[model samples]
Target: MRHAGPKLLTQIAAVHFVSHVHIMLIPALLPVLPGLLGVGFIELGVALAVFNIISALVQAPLGYAVDHYGARRVLKAGLLLGSLSFLLLAASPGYALLLVTMALAGLANGVYHPADYALLAKGIEPGRLGRSFSLHTFAGFLGSAVTPAIFLGIAAVLGTRAALAAGAVFGAAALLLISIPGSGVYRVAEVGNKGCAGPVPATGRVRLFTPMIGVLTVLFILLNLSTSAIEKFSVAALVQGQGLTLTWANTGLTAFLLCSAAGVLCGGALADRTRRHGLVAAMAFALAAALTALVALGVLWDWALVGVLGAIGLLTGIIAPSRDMLVKAAAPPGAEGKTFGLVSTGFNIGGAIGPVVFGWLLDRGLPSGVFVASVVFMVLTVGLTLAQEVFMARKGRGALRYQR
Candidate 1:
């Protein structure tokens, strides 16, 4: 098989970055929108929800399309549609228009992971596939991390419309870059048989939907629930529930994000060295859960609070590459797009439900419940990871026995 090498990694990572930036653009502009559009925050919230729900509904089907049509074609369409969604946002004339625009954005966002992962699965060298996945994820996190500053800065200087227009420009540029020959994205058949990049059996009737896939999906949801709790509510919970200063609270959140980014880089290196991805995920989530549980105790103060939160971030970040590898291991041949697409829906599902669940706990004067719930979910993730390994091992043994 042709190895796409660094160029491909860079191209895919760039798209991942732009896609995340586009996804986050609306949220960054949210506070400004109510005044501009003459609507209430509740209405704005509903618009955002519509975008996410639509994206969730379409993710799996889009993944299937990636396998059928081609990753490059589907990915280009997603990029184009995502860019157009921003253009629509820039020109949105009313609340109804804004709602329609967000739905467009969701459709564009939904196809990304399936196509992106499919490309990586086929294009990247086997030894470095884990790092390739890491870079792809890291690019996304960087996009989210930078969106507030990038768009808000543009909005301040050039006006909101210009800022959104700038987003459209980014999508166009990504489309052109990936369209170039020697870019990482390839047609499915262009990939030669790279041995043991986690292959499924060839003889039997293949099934993409399996107990392992279901368990992996649930694992993704639970992991995101823990993360969303911290990302969305940790600051407020720290202030109101733990009586921490806003400065300290925000610092903890910031530390969590920064450390998590750093941990992703570290995890990539570890991923290249080992195939025991399930063990890596299990240990990381288990450690993260313990650190999160400490925060629930509310005994830490100031720096200690930030330190513990950072620890949780680090552990979870380390789990990411391993988690992706685990999913790749469980995938049936030629089903990369559909499998990733299906599992990634868990993120949207968890993200949709997490805020409400964690927010309710905070509203009810149970701040500790936020952390406690996160720990519970993380523990569940640990269990799922272990169970998935056992199941995969059994299947492997059964396949070998059948061959004999």
Candidate 2:
């Protein structure tokens, strides 16, 4: 087989990029939901929980399909499912259908990531891995970054229903494009596609590195939960608890995501040099970042405060690619998706647990608990990282997750 080509990368990246655009529409809509639907925070929480819980449970099975059945089939099906699910959201005459649609959309959302990343891992040359992953991630972030503006514009010009309908149209277009003959990962993997080059002859010895895989999964889980905790509660804490305005609250949140984008770019470029050590550096940054977040809550953060929050976001992106590389290297044969699914499952668990606990603390009137919880989670993850490094060293890494 020949090497992978740029066209396929762009195609995969395009699908990934637009898919995020679809997801981000939900968050911006959250603020408007109460006025639009007469629902309160409890109902909104239920909506989000239902969507994510369904996603968490179904990821492993869908990922397993991506591993054995091929990404083409899974990707195409997910696209269709995703597009149709929005119609469910649009057609919902009641909360039950909304729940169903959101959960289905979540399931469809779960299908894309592991399959897409695993496909990239299999097809791309090793030297280009960091760039490929980073570009793909950046594409998604770029889509998300534009979401607020898009939502603001749509809500202003077309009204909520029409704007969302336009989004569904976008999803539908993606579904159609993904289904086109030789258009998606499946066809790219097909022989004679010229772009995807199908399966590479190279495969990593992953089973021997189970310990690394397990630890990495744990870290990803902790990281996702830690992030969700801050994102979910930080705004509410600032606005309601701390009495800051919504706009100011949002500025801090946006800073975090934007900085994360910067971190990923830097992390990707540095991977070839530091390899595993890049992750250690990222974790160290996260330690400092969590501390900063705690401090910011106690003090007043202004424009300069955005810089610190941005640094926190930067740590997430910088740390992520290294962890992804570890999982890619450690994935067992015919189990890339399942491996990712397991890791994603951990994310879901964190996603689920974090908000409830954080909200609980908030309801209890311990505004500091949210930041404290984030600190504790980060601390635990760092401890896990250090323990794994020490264990690997003493055992001579008796695992091959990283090279000497």
Task: State the weakest 10-residue window (summed lDDT) of model 2.
Answer: 200-209
**Residues 229-256, model 2: lDDT tens digits:** 6666778776666666788778988888
Predicted structure 2: lDDT: 0.69
Clashing pairs in 1: 8-184
lDDT of 2 at 177: 64
- What do the candidate models score in CA lDDT, each in turn? 0.85, 0.69
Residue 64 deviation, candidate 1, in Å? 0.9
User: How big is the RMSD of model 2?
Assistant: 4.0
Off by over 4 Å in 1: 186-206, 398-404
